[model samples]
Target: MRMPQGKPGRRAAVPPWLRARHPDPVQDDPRICPDQTRGQLGLFPTPPRQFARTHAARISDRTVPGFEAVREELRKMADERQIRARTIWLWRLEGIARLALAARDPDREQVAPQALKDLLYSGPILGQALHRAGLLAPTASHRLVPPRGTGPTRQGGQRDLDLRGQCAHCLAWANDRRVLCAACTSWGYHIRKHGGGEAECNRCRRTLMVSDGMCRMCRIIVAETEVDTARIAMDYGDQLWFARPHAAGLAVGPRTSGTAAARGRFAHKRRLARARAADELQPSEHVLNPAQLELFPAPTRDWSRLNTATPPALTTAAADLVADFFAYMRGRGWNINFFRGSIRTLRILTGHLGADAPIRECDIRALVSTGIHVQGARLINYLRLRGLLEAQPPRDLSVARARRSASTISSPAFAAAVHTFIDVLLGQGSTPSRPRSSKTIENYVATVLDTIETWIAQGLGDPREVTKKHIEDALKPLHGDQARRLHTALRSLFRALKRERLVFRDPARSISLPSNRPVPAGLPSDRVAGLLDRIDDPRERLMVAFVAIYALLPGQLVQLQRTDFDRSKGRLRLRRAGRMDHIVYLDEFTLRLAAAWELHRHHRWPDSSNPHLFVNRNTAVDETGPPISTAAVTLLFQRVGLPAGRLRIDRIVDEAHHSADPLRLIELFGLSTASATGYVLSAHPDRKPGPIAP
Candidate 1:
């Protein structure tokens, strides 16, 4: 559990500070700083004490025994008119003394002194005035005069008296559950349980008295909504409960228009104020307790404990720096693109800005360039929306850089890592949106880790070799599967390693993979024809039949466009269609069916300007070319009675069957690596590792 750091309170200034610093000299241990946490509180006072003697002429009513007689008289008066309960109590207390004194001795007993009682009931000054007139012996005559000092309450040598808050209902806890108690839950007349003398309800008002745990008229009043539920509370009253005023946005009244409403609100405030004053109380800030935590069912996957790696480079400071950069750009009127995907990339690039950085440009390409063709397109779309890409994107650039394309996190490794975490947190597994023939995300993880381990082994021994060439030399010995995996991991590292600026240059620069096939074989030819012929759905039949005839790669088979076959032109124009070179033309039968199906799907002429011919009906976007999803089409063919087969009996996409094509089967499916557009023959496959040429 993380322990929260407490915020420091505000420092008091001037009057408050000075008063807090100094204390009354009269008291013992009168050091100003009372709290240990605050250490020594500095108090300043220039003037020295000028003590003056105080005196009062009148003494307390307790000196005389006429209290009983006074109470009777007041009760008689109360019978006829009005007197407060407190007043009645005072009279009774005085009367008891007076009556008892009379019983002691008639001759020596002085008459019950009204003057002395006056001093006790009223303050010292009133009693003193009467005493000076020679009516009473008031030994304790002087009230502490002129109040010792002058300043704020805390500053002045007077107590910060308990605030007399208005009477309001406050919540209290009972047992383990919430409940209302005597305050709001129960009502009763409260007669003083420990009675000095009996108290009658304020003379002439409904009589109510509190004794023990009971009250008379209190019960009736409690049911009454109008009962004084209002309560007075000190600013920091221990048991006080307060709620914010009902008015919201009222504080933000129009500059001039709502004067009336503001006045009304202020008037209500004034009423509450007046009520407080009547009770000798004031308004104060309300403090509340933190709520207890409630329990929830445990998560499906336990993340509570694991030696989870703390993200090394993705520091909060770096994240903040990136945010500030965006904000700064926004402030400067820069046209900025907003995207969550770029969050990781920007975080990696500048998060550790000026710190030991790991990011460089080449990692950019591996991050952004690889993956489904549409991945880059999606990012481009996002950047364009944010105003990052000002101009339209150009046609496909044959060659891609590993360093320049990373916009998400540096590379596939981060993507894999993030995906791994996401899956673990969700209690599932991660897979790439566009998975390769045999590459699992776990494989990427293993490969990346391997690549990192190799680097660490080679370079950790000597830090100087951590340069780009050193990485290149380390990679030079690698080839085939290891080389690809090594390069892939290196790619991911370089992509995210931008901020570290570890590499002298893009390490994977000038390195390219070879065109190869894991061709399917060992199936009789009849099974292939039978699979295609058994398909009844015209679309599935044509798709499968065409794949069989052309022996195209999965990408080419999926990338087939409506424009590939032109009914008017009577030919299929295949662009770098696959690992094959040469323009492919479909047979009349296949071309006609593809064209007819497209024509049949059109409920009405499609909106002008869409170029895709084999468009997915489900995807509503106006695609550049009408398209069909390869996976969906493959599945559809299987649903339509196609059987398991290899080269001849090949299942198009399912793992159960491996589909393959010969390396030089180009003419059968016209495809050019550079531009599949209206192809011509090439002696070899395009340098860009796409379709191989016949």
Candidate 2:
């Protein structure tokens, strides 16, 4: 192919093949110069040369002699480079021009020539440029001299002081020289300022300025809140002494406050004045007005003080017996009230027997001869129980029967049958395949034994002689459910007897009872509110809320532990027998109440090892301090004149009516399908039944 030759001043020819690929190559290609060819491809292009010349001319026009020298040097370097000479020269020129423009005075039109030259060749500036372009060796120290005409360097120590002036702890900004910001300073200041130097109100523990030792708010609260000061003083005279009115006003004082200390000093003075009156007191003067004595009992003389001085005229054996009686009462968990009553009884016995009498001479018969025989009988019983007296007290048949009521059976065969049946139900006897709850077995056995005993008391002595007529007579007075329960127990008993070949016929086999009953509608809302309000204790209120709002059964509530409540999720999970576990979502109010009750429970029973959600405060009777029994809960509701069971039924009925979904009710309350269906029907009796889908 033929090549096209260049025009007069144009440098070279382009090969025809190159021209053919791009016809009129200069006009077609933006990057290719008309005078440039592949032979000069590595050399500087004309466009970059023209750009450098224009920039150098502008720098020269500014009369920056240092910049002009830099531009000339850049040109020399460009000529030395074989490749990208013009581009390299342009970049170095641009870098020197930028430094000159930056170093120029803001008020002046031109930069200092010497300063511009110094900055252009400075190690820091050149090293920075190389570092920015990623051409400097990373391992090599890139530290360079500071450029001339730069402002003063920041003081390291001043910067550290500024940083420290800001909160050293929280690192928040501070206006003044402080280690901590205003907020942090205030927090610590308040803590130390109010720690404990000032006197605090006894009721609320708020700081008090008045030496009376109560803040204004607590004083107002005490004024508004009614308290029987007279009754409190009468009952606890030593602990609750009233102060005289001061010039300011009448202020109710707590025994734990400063007023109490003042009152104690005044009381000491009064006691000194009363010493003469006490010395003049005759035997007859000791007799108190019966009416006044009922409100504030006459103080008993401290016999221990007299005994310590004169060893009490009573024999050593008698003193030992008295001491042992008190020890036994204490070991049995008797309260101080019992000790007080026992002390009074002992005083009467000692006065009657004459304090000098021997313990062996003080027989129960002789004590009974004094006409106050009940005290004598109690003392004799205690002596016998403690093995101090050998002769056992006569056993009253009525008391014996009452004590043995739970175990008593009319016939030995019936008793044996009942035991065997319980063992079978508990998976311990001959027919032990069908295991049952021990509690359920106990209930069934009690009912069966009671029914059998009643029949025997009515003249049917033998199980074989008892007929269906006797069973009907015994169950006649009971309600429908009660009758059904009795019948079921009797039927199971007779079946077990027949299995054991002890009886041939089942008296309760023919007795049929209704299988379903309408669910009871709960107490009215106003009544429920009143009952809940009547329960002031947080623990009791929370328990009632569980039954009334969550529809928890007594057994479920009693079994609930702290682990059952999911605080994060605000849900209570319960495991029930014969149904899927239930999860109840708690509302904010209920959750708050639960939390408050939990805190109160911990405070009241701090030493308790019980994990129950609700626990009784009394740990003497129950060593483990378990949850309050269902009977105790029932009694609580009874005291408030509300039925706990009815409240639970009300909650269930309310939920059933509101949702009308049997499956939802079953899931929510752990109710059986049949029970849920019954509750739904009872809630909305007028609703038509839907067709069953098969």
Candidate 3:
């Protein structure tokens, strides 16, 4: 025998060659000489294959009963299985087979008795309790046992029966005859019947039926789930499923009630309604803060002196409230400064309830008057909070009016006189009910006379009795030019009177008086250079320069002259420039231009005033200005011979051809579209201004 070699550390395994060669003294003929036999057999046969030989012999021995009979017995066994499969199975003793099928394969309950037991149970298609928990019971073959970690197991625990399975009471006595599982103890049947029984419905897996039936929509959407007619294997609910809210009600309670989900719909609806207008108006702080200055009413008196006086002291809370209100309005894109809306509310409040809005209500009417849209809704909100908004409308204001009649104006003469002149002044019967200045009154008188004469020829002498139809007739004969002017007057008056009780109730209560517009001011040419030369103030010189480069009015330039400039950042602002108080931005050229002029001029402005750059000095002589009159500005333009009549109306006073070519300049500066560019159309000393793009 050959000894195996091994290292000192490891004892070597014995080689197979050394163990047994069967002592073949010689390499016996490759198969006993290919055909040689021992004794009476012609074949030496292959070396015994022990297990195979044993099985074959047993198979052959069984044939002694008679080959055909053995075959018949095998057939009988197979036929018996087939017969058992044909009939419906009624469960009997709970065994490993039954329990395993119940766990790993739910459909096994309805399958043929002989359908491959383990295959049917462990099949991918037949799913039972679908969860992290594993099989109900281990199968007869230990290999078929389900993986662990299902619900706590008790079948093989210490006690005869555990809390998870059969309990002590289930036996009734010490070791009573039977040991049943918890399911069998609780109900006569196993959990297979009590469980949801595949209770999922396509319409609502979350829903359960009150009487243990399908949910309402489920019944409508899922039909005929019998196995034979798997004809209707469904992935989802049928088409045309019932709608929500109503559909949600169906899930109320198959076995338990849940009405909260249904109630949630109403809450969601209310939330949506309140938030619908949240995105309506939102303005940035930078834009609104500077612009709101224009929103303040032109003070009842010249506040030029008032500006020097200290503003009224605000209470800390009042100040904070005002700050926040300004912040809030700016956030909503409003360039509002005065409590115009709030004070109007104050006015109304003072009118009603004697002196103020309920302190608790804090007023909203002011916001509305300022062109903000939220006040009506805000008023409604507070009233609701106060438990008053939802209350029925109060008995008509007429009752209140009757009670207050003593204060009512008794003479019709004042109102009537104003009414009779309405047609002549407004070119119609009524104008907006707005307060007017002496200038507005004069304009009104001039326009009224014109309208009356024109109407008289068309047969309308008195506008007091003029109905809408009659006014239209009177308006028909006027040219578009005249009609447009009349419309403007009417529109202006109506907007102003919207809040007045008389105006709200009567369309005719509008103001017939014309607008007392401040005659737009500008400096004259002969006066402008003279005025500029006289001003020694560097600040005012810078201010004049800005007015020239950017068309800003005097007051507008004054308010915007402080820390906002950043020479490095390249931005300049015309803080507030219009009735709307629009904030205007300028590029770096502005800063450099102002700096250059200041260094060269060596002038200084009033020491007591704000860092504001401008101050008018010689206006009393002709127009009250450090420079010149509004009249002077216009006359200067006329002398220069640029298109004067139209540009003045548009407020675009300065013009230079950005492109040198006349036609190109006209096109680039937007001259073709409106009156603003008309300068390019006129013959110019030079072709135009700047280099053309093309």
Candidate 4:
């Protein structure tokens, strides 16, 4: 044997004379070259070439009996650890097999079953490998044992079992017995000679004592302590117990049963019912804190006092007209605020016209007598629209007609040109196609008319003589949105006119609007809290919170149905514009507030059949009011001096400041990448402001 020169375990380099001449000793033929096996195998007769080939073929074909089983066990373990690659699993298997082979004799050609078993159960590296491979049991309580004589020998005539057999009592491996295992002899099945008892606990099947049909541990749980019983009785009141005020005793006995026990049970149930009723009546702390409570005091006026019934002083005809108007507004989806305003207006209108005056006899003059000119005009228009009053020509009709007939180069002529352009857009002219809808055409024409009127007022009336300077002058005074609209409309009109050869030039083409300016910084945190504190209505407070914290749009907030809120998961599922559902996790405060609001809403509108989470309070016309409109939600925020758009911008900016990642904004707030990037840039103090294209 050769030894290494320096290292303790390193092998020495073999001398050239002693080195094997052939790379593979198995393939070396001693008959062909007598020097190949000069020392050892040369003394024996050389095996035939055919025998060598057959032996090698047999060796290649051999396989372990339970190789597939071992592989499957390893696959399960790999899957448990989220290792999906097949090559990695194969490598692990190869390592485990090599370790198993090297565990005992290194020179052995085959691994012994006894040696493999010992390696598996030795609780070492090999044991862990076997456990991971699912060949060895995970816990001793569920260990398997080999059949009777097939197991390994142990001390005291005992035997160690394989992983296939288990003890009957504890489901663990038994040394020799077929039923009870050696380790489970004491606590599990008791031998007949060792005082085996017949009585056993129904729960754990352990031996029972004289008290009840349970073991000590189970008895301790089923039988309440005196302290526990007394606590329950004292805290909740004397309705839960059946025992007659016994001296603070704590003992296990037969369950009490009698008329008194039955009565006690009934009283306990009644008390629970009363407590639930009281809970419903009390304001929920979860919904509002002390500060919020101080901000929004409870309503003292009786809801029944509202004049939902017919006004006693009004005539039948007048009352009928008022009812019809209310119904009309309700069908149009007008909010509670509108309903209230209309009600107040109606009171003033009815008061102006005496109770005896017929509704048909009333006119705009009657509304004007109330000393509110705007309200009078609105009332007259509404009554006329609803056919409750005689229709009359609008006050501006003569002016509009005169402008259309005028031919001179004046403001009226410009107005007439605008009307003609509007007609062209509405597909009432020589144009071949009407690409814009009536609503869009009206909006475009209105914008163009505004610019034309501005120019005519500046003493420039000839449409042919309109220049880019005039267009720029018209656009300069306007804000970004107004300028953009006017520019687009004028461009469209000029393009149409040029195609028709009506204009020699299209001056609007050179007109451009500046990019939208970033929103102003939001109110300070203390100011925002102060604003929230001023909102007394719970529903309004929740609506503002959604905008102020989550940056939910008005449309999104109004469209929220009861099903969107998941109380158990503390998540709100919002369906965005593209019908994609976005889930937002609620914080502790929001969760509690939501829970309280849900309870309050349920109680306030118990009979309401609307599925919307937020509903209108106009119960007179709509018994079960509809979902709150986006306009109403906007007004709610406006009432507290917070613009919804600015609130959303502030929230996005704050989020950007914290994360400084535009992608996070896009993911959380559903903003476009460009929009998110703009907000992020605006948040940075070092970044210069640049114009983004409108």
Report the error of model 3 at residue 486, Å: 2.2
Output the number of the TM-score-best candidate: 2
The lDDT per prediction is 0.38, 0.55, 0.35, 0.55
lDDT of 1 by residue, 1-694 (tens): 2333573554434476667788533321212211132222122211222111111111122233443444454455455555457575544444333323322222222322332342244423323322333333334332211122432245655643221121222222211112223433233322233342234332112223433222333222222212222442222122212342322211211112122223544456546656565465222122111242427632223222422222223344444545665674454343455334444444433322221232223333344443322123323333333433323334322111111122133345433443443233223433223222222334544445544455555534322244566566766787777777777655654533332343355555555567463433334446455665565655565666665655555456566565565666666666662333346666777776776666655543343234554445333222233345556755664675443233422322221122123222323433233222212112222432445745
Candidate 1: stretches off by over 4 Å: 1-450, 453-522, 533-536, 577-581, 604-609, 620-666, 671-694
lDDT of 3 by residue, 1-694 (tens): 3345664556566567765754424322232212222222111112211122222222221212122332333344435556564222211111222322222222222322222243333322222221112322333322221122222434765432222221222211112123433322433333245553334443345333221444433432332221112233344333332223334433322322232233444456435544553333232222212223455533222222321111233333334434554564454343355334543332232222221122223233332444452234323332444333223333433323322331232334323433433322334434543333333444543443444455445654333333445445545676555765665554443333333222433233442334343322333545444434554545544554455545555435445554555456655544432223333445565675567654543332222223433323222111112333345444444544432333332233334333324444333222334333344333243543568635
**TM-score-based ranking:** 2, 4, 1, 3
Return the lDDT, model 4, position 156. Answer: 90
Q: What's the residue-level lDDT of 306 in candidate 1? A: 22
**What's the number of clashes in each of the models?**
82, 0, 39, 4
The sequence of per-residue lDDT tens digits that candidate 2 reaches over residues 250-349 is 3444433223223444456445545544454322222222234245522324332232211223334455666776786566555646445444445444
Any runs in candidate 3 off by more than 4 Å, and if so which? 1-446, 449-464, 469-482, 494-570, 576-589, 596-612, 618-639, 643-694
Q: Residues 257-329, candidate 4: write the lDDT tens digits.
A: 2212234545565566555644444221222122323455333223233332222244455567668767766
Worst 10 residues of 2 by lDDT: 41-50
Error of 2 at 188 (Å): 71
Report per-prediction Cα RMSD to one decimal.
27.4, 37.4, 31.5, 36.8
What TM-score, over all chains together, does every model reach? 0.28, 0.41, 0.24, 0.36
Better of 1 and 4 by lDDT: 4
Residue 491 in candidate 4, Cα distance off native in Å: 4.4
